[model samples]
Target: MLDTQMPTPKPRVIAGESHDWELVIGLEVHAQVATKAKLFSGASTTFGAEPNSNVAFVDAGMPGMLPVINEECVAQAVRTGLGLKAEIHLTSAFDRKNYFYPDLPQGYQISQLYHPIVGEGEVLVELGPNDQGTPTARTVRIERIHLEQDAGKSIHDMDPALSFVDLNRTGVALMEIVSRPDIRGPEEAAAYVTKLRQIMRYLGTCDGNMQNGNLRADVNVSVCRPGQYEKYQETQDFGHLGTRCEIKNMNSLRFIQAAIEVEARRQIAILESGGSVTQETRLYDVEKGETRSMRSKEEAHDYRYFPDPDLLPLDIEQAWVDDLAAHLPELPDAKKARFIGDFGLSDYDASVLTADTTSATFFEAVVAASGNGKASANWVINDLFGRLKKDDREIAESPVSPAQLGGILKLIEAGDISGKIAKDLFEIVYTEGGDPAEIVAARGMKQVTDTGAIERAVDEIIAANPDQVEKARVNPKLAGWFVGQTMKAMGGKANPAEVNRLVGQKLGQ
Candidate 1:
């Protein structure tokens, strides 16, 4: 129920200095539905499988084979639509898009064109920087979400003179979510994708794995005069919006931004040079950071879209939509607010922990087990997260489990180990998991909390460095060195405050 009739603002364009052109962008994101089977066949949706090993007869378009829709895929699409707050179509039908490709054994892809499954929705994309320097949010309108089958991949590296077709990906279920050209800048566009990915991950509908091609976007780029968008708003003329070119297969955020910028500049140059920007499909080269023409953009008629004859229209009851909505997981924004309010964490901390579902779950577990919110937050953000980044690992793949991490925090809180000693104990727990108490005992990493033991260590250090003591008695600043050495001699386990008190008493002026 978004307001598509709202006046679309015009972007700023400098005159003469820049030919006064505004870049208008829209995105069509193809997210592979997180289901075990293909859209029409029972073939495995696993990646990295041997070529053609995962395809079924229907996927290969064998004669007499009929398409059967996967119920799980339909449920997943509904789940995602609910997460996006989109309107679910009670009755939706599929269509056949006729096209010719070497890898498409069916010669036409089964997709939802005229009647999509999900209707208008809105996504709030963070635009500016967050409190922690992360980006802020911007609201973008969703045009529609349609279910479609993916085409097979064409591999050209198998032979020197010939190419090969891999149908493993053929007929994989995909949700082609289209967005309006409401995004104004490249940063907002990237943030929009990031937010969409986060939502899909939370909904458990899409894995959002860009590297493996589970999620990809097709960018629509157009240029207009600074005030032309306003005029289009008043007239509702699509032509006044200027011709648009589609950039295909943009998998990464960096490449998405770069491709949009380059394509816009290329179009601006053409327009400024008295040439028209051709409406076509183009490919983005990550290495070269440029887009090259693929082919002239095709219209719906070019594909000859027709109602799929083999499959019936999908019909779902309102009760089911209500059930899915009832079970929706705590989304990112809600979880972030809860983390901030319940744990007393800063907004930045909340944002970081809630960015990913696994990280947020892990943090909550550690805090609950340790019963120390602040200390647990510190360990999660500093110790565990630092190691995860250094080793290029994710929170789910951490070597240290939540219980073990909680044990470390508990030991530090109880004064059973000093901060420095606890770091070593953390390493032991991370590299070799076990009872933290046992690790501390095995390594003799107990803190010198007893006043007598700490005083003895401090006195011995002062006696060993008499000249340093004399300097400290006179300057009072040199006592810090003695304190450091005393702690170091005791393997960083001596109580630091007690050491300081003893050192100051020995160096009485």
Candidate 2:
């Protein structure tokens, strides 16, 4: 899916006092693996639990308790690597990254440095609209994916006089996905993270709930003068890329964009002022809307990485990887393409429906039950999605089930109820659950499809509007008004196609 030759837009240039500079961006997204237990312990990986309640001996890093690898966690990492079309290392080893922090129960955190689970991969990121509003797609390269253990959370807000450490998240499984500096703009950076989250969610390896800290990203941003990037490309020299400052633990997509803009502007101002940009780690302040230095950036040597002595190197079999690939479900891109080909959906509509696995499953179930792909897609995307947003609900929390929605669409297809009646039925089912057919029958909501009744209604409307009739006879486009008037008179229970037909026949169009 990598399309490096797809003509990219002009670099995102920042105008300086004398020269124009372009932005270079890379992201390190850390996604928590979805598992029932912690990576190295049997502790429950439940969120919102009492502090320290889920801790196990291994999770607490107690003396004489050695780390044990969770087989499911390792499998999840491999599955994620395959989903990204990355190369899986059959033999990989874990290293201890030494760092002293209050939240890290183990003085040395287990991570992969020289050997990682996954190798180079690429992702296609869809970005801004063209002149006609069609999105432009660009490809971003992934450097590697490594498995690591997460540090616990430090709480400083409970009481001003004290700081608390919550070890519930300690030793949890994390997949650090590192990206090459292929992103050229802030929007593209956000899009890359969004796409990675979507893919991981589809694979079921990660829930990708940014609000709950299940997924987070560290963005590396640099600014360089125009035409330097091409030189770097030719010589394969990273020096052509300006000094990059790492922005740590960004969760919100909006905040990611804002932080990138602020950081890039900060670097540009420094370069223009005859000051060399420093290589350091920084934090983005949401309220102040600026970037502040946190600490000096550390290289791999600073972490002092070494193979963990207690654990043996992991060696996976190709047959096992193939089995996992065989079991892999249809991914987002394939599903979107199939929806467009089979269901006659627009690209945008298919993209929206297939962005999340739950939404796509619900949509397909509705289509299967109703046997009307076009109508089913319209209802799910327009009516159901709109109502869910208004109620602040996710599709999983929808009051109306797919079977009920299919029932409503079925009634509309069978000519038992009009579209307007279907809308009323949807509202009823949403507020109070019941069968669509039963509700329609009990409330006498079916359309009057009898030809005699439809003819009579059409005649009355035409007789009442002779001027409109004349206008319609002369101008065929004006006949729509009569059709509208007749449907309005019938309380929206009249079959719309039948009404349009009778109106046209009576008006001699």
Candidate 3:
């Protein structure tokens, strides 16, 4: 839980020639609920289906086809609310948001307006480091999380004279998480979205795949005087924060950050020139790096929202919500703290491990198998993660499994294989798939742990390079050369610790 009384961070300001303006941001993230079927239809929700192949009669808005709600979507939304530490309303009703689009076969959307399923929640966003180099965080308060149906795609590029509508996504359930205007800048906005995605993914409520439009954010941006935001917070006045423009369907974090900067500057430019910023919906052009007006922002009244006549008000039991709350998975923040405390990892390392469930699960499995938290973290992060990144693969797709990597670490811990030999064994296991111990034994890769053998190898190097040995006696740092030569002469199978001890002992150091 975050302290509600935490100090409001200083506003992020953009300097104009005459005055500096503060940026006020909020996000309405639409996360498609993880369910097998559409919200009001029996149609499959599988992605990458043939265009319009997944549509049901009701989804296509065919006459005399009544809608039926999918109960799993509701449960997923409630689960997400509990994960975010939000209040779940026992009774929530759906409304019809009337609109017209070729992709919206229903001619309007079914959404929650007057009463949302989830009430106020808070998301703790980490904003990198501050002046003192400590991790800085801000709590972005969620206004509501409401469920709605998604519109289909409008394919305009297929033909010069015609546009096509793909109704595959129509009627899919969406959880629109609305946040207050607490975010101060583009970075905070991006962080807020990322944290939401992380939390939802952990809850298994949403997949958070922005590329496939499983998750998207509609950013609300406005510029105000620096202290005006504080006043708005105190007075609860929307006017204090200037007119906000909604940037629609921001799927990429980089694009979200860039859109905020460009939109804030665009608003700043308008206000500085003695013109009012328009309250409208806009789109960010990736190529031009500019925001263009899409349409005037619609108010609730304009959408003509009313209690959805086709469906009854949804009333769920408190016991069901409690049941979901009890079974919630360990979230990112809690997992991160546990990683820090239980594994003795640094804050950054913990953050990296808990950034996603797959990496976290893999690391824990490695730790469990190897019984070395620090070494497991080092191998998983530096070696395994680096290799995965270089190969452009995810942890689930890695060539080396956690058990295999843990086996390699076990060999190192038991002094069965030197670090250099471990790398060679790792390569063989990764590329050819073999047990580390078996490979080490079969290929004579076992470390030369016997002091006598190490001593003989050291003496040979010392005899072959007497001048170097004398120089090693003069400068202790030169002793490393002897260690390297002895290890190489032993085919890198000698224990590094024993080799160092033998080298220092032979040099009388």
How much lDDT does each candidate structure score?
Answer: 0.86, 0.91, 0.91
lDDT of 3 by residue, 68-116 (tens): 9999999999999998889999999999999898999889999999989
lDDT of 2 at 341: 88
- Greater TM-score among 1 and 2 belongs to 2
Better of 1 and 3 by lDDT: 3
TM-score for every candidate vs. truth? 0.90, 0.95, 0.97
lDDT by residue for model 1 (1-509), tens: 11223333335353434567777789999999999999998999999999899999999999999998898898899888888889999899999999998989988999999889999898876554545654444568898999999999988888989989899999999999999887776767788899899999999999999999999999998888877777876887868778999999889998898898888888888888888988999998788878899999999999999999998998989998889889999998788878877888886788788888999999999998799887888899999999989999999899999999999888888889878888888898889889998888887888888888888888788878888878887898888998899888887888777788888887883
Clash number for candidate 1: 8
Number of clashing residue pairs in every model?
A: 8, 0, 0
Candidates in descending TM-score order: 3, 2, 1
Tell me the tens digit of each residue's lDDT in model 2 across 462-493: 88999988889999999999889888888888
Worst ten in a row by lDDT for model 3:
1-10
Q: Clashing residue pairs, candidate 3?
A: none
Question: Number of clashing pairs, model 2?
Answer: 0
